[model samples]
Target: MQKSLRVGQILYTNVLPVYYYFDQPKFEDRIQFIRQVPAQLNQAMAAGEIDLGPISSFSYAEHASQYVALADLSVSAKGRVGSLFLFSKKPIEQLNGAKIAFTNTSATTVNLLKIILLKFYDYEISYVTQEPVLEEMLLGADAALLIGDDAIQAKRNSHNLHVYDLGELWHQFTGYSMTFAIWALRKAAIADHHDLIAEVHASFLDSKRKTKENPAPLIDYVHTHFGGEKEEWVRYFQGLQHDFGDVQRIGLEYYYRCAAELGLLAAPTTVDLWQAGGRQTKTTLTR
Candidate 1:
């Protein structure tokens, strides 16, 4: 008997490539994935709304035991990740007294921004999650964490605002890949539908390739989620690459190390995603 595995994904342009299930009838019937912002997706995963999808790295750490990570699969760039951003109406130091807005889309970026504030700038700022608009937060908070399309448009300041790049922040702090999210599965789901996980991953990869060859199907989806320049969004989708291999471990470890350094987690554990626990032997990317 075959059962569809429920999966969850974030609502960002960079993540659209993973939704290839929409076009594949075979995987579609077997997939019960929901598209939501990272934080919401994390909640869905924790609540058993879906088995797995790309999730915020911080959320994974918070509930490490509940899920197993597809270590090779993640959203991270070596440098210059143009999506995540931190903006303030004043200098980072001056931002201490001002109101700032944070995006509610991702749990990981929130903490990631906090690390930059506490460590790099030496600012004891009050962090709050208010709807992200310069007017809404600048009216009351000191700084804001903006991500995805909201970050894209809002962070582009006219010279008065100070922007602290989260990707660059992580690069400066840890020399490995700064993983934002990875395909994650509920711990129990792996026990029953392990093979389906691989198949779905393959399906996702195939979709990514198809989108890369012709992004027309997702252009609107990408433009809507990414927000800034249409060409920039198009270019972003062109650059996304998903791997199901060890290339992601360093980044995963780096994320955990950074979280640990910030006292976010006590001792983090790494998943041998090659075998992914419960599985019998190491399976290389045959997809």
Candidate 2:
């Protein structure tokens, strides 16, 4: 018999479709949801604490051998994922060597920022926790990376902060969408129930129909799931974009190339994505 599935998810607002899925009695018992921040989610997955979860794309590349991406989901906008913010009291260039505040909330975004800053921006800044206070970052640092709700809240400040959205930044640099989170599974576990991966992707598409039209129901679902402030979560979900779009999406290529450039992967290649009707075969990355 197949083992019961354990699922993990980040508590971010972009995951409403997955949350709404629990409404279906078909999946409720078999699939258990582990509500956690992205950073913790990835660690748990790496440590084998959970079998499946929406892992940050960076982790997929970092720990490629351990996990295989099951379904494409939780991507950032091409030109604007407002939730990812790079705030600086000083300019990026000016902050040569400083302590940068990082939201330890997400591994992918944190690593992405680190790579971008080190490789492209030439910023030699160390990452510090977002807690204790923003005041700490302000006093002892050059900039801060605040993501999700924290980023949203920081953006509202009256102070002048240079906010560089990673999606927009990557699009301007590479002309491709940034996929933030991907549904990933333990590679060993995928052999027997690969069909279930397809089903989950199908399920995401079906839920999108109900969610794509009206924002209220999805928002309500988020509020119920996380016990968060409803109106804000609704507006945030309304702003997010979630179309995996037939598998030939530009985001996958961007991921491959970036991974290669970082020497995380040997080469770049197209991902052979599968839609609802068939079992998806894994695509090797080659340039």
How do the predictions measure up, each by TM-score?
0.82, 0.80
Top-lDDT structure, candidate number: 1
In terms of lDDT, model 2 sits at 0.67
Candidate 1, which segments miss by more than 4 Å at Cα? 1-3, 20-22, 93-100, 156-159, 213-228, 238-241, 244-247, 274-287
Candidate 2 segments exceeding 4 Å error:
129-133, 191-199, 219-239, 245-249, 252-256, 259-278, 284-287
Kindly report which residue pairs in candidate 1 clash with one another. 6-51, 98-141, 98-142, 99-141, 99-142, 100-141, 100-142, 100-143, 101-144
Instruction: Tell how far residue 131 is off in model 2, in angstroms.
Output: 3.9
Tens digit of per-residue lDDT, candidate 1, span 79-173: 55677877666666575544446777777778777666667666666667777676576667655677876777765562576777787777776
lDDT string, candidate 2, 208-272, tens digits = 66677666777776577656577767656655666654432466566667656766557654443
Error of 2 at 6 (Å): 0.5
N/CA/C clash count, model 1: 9
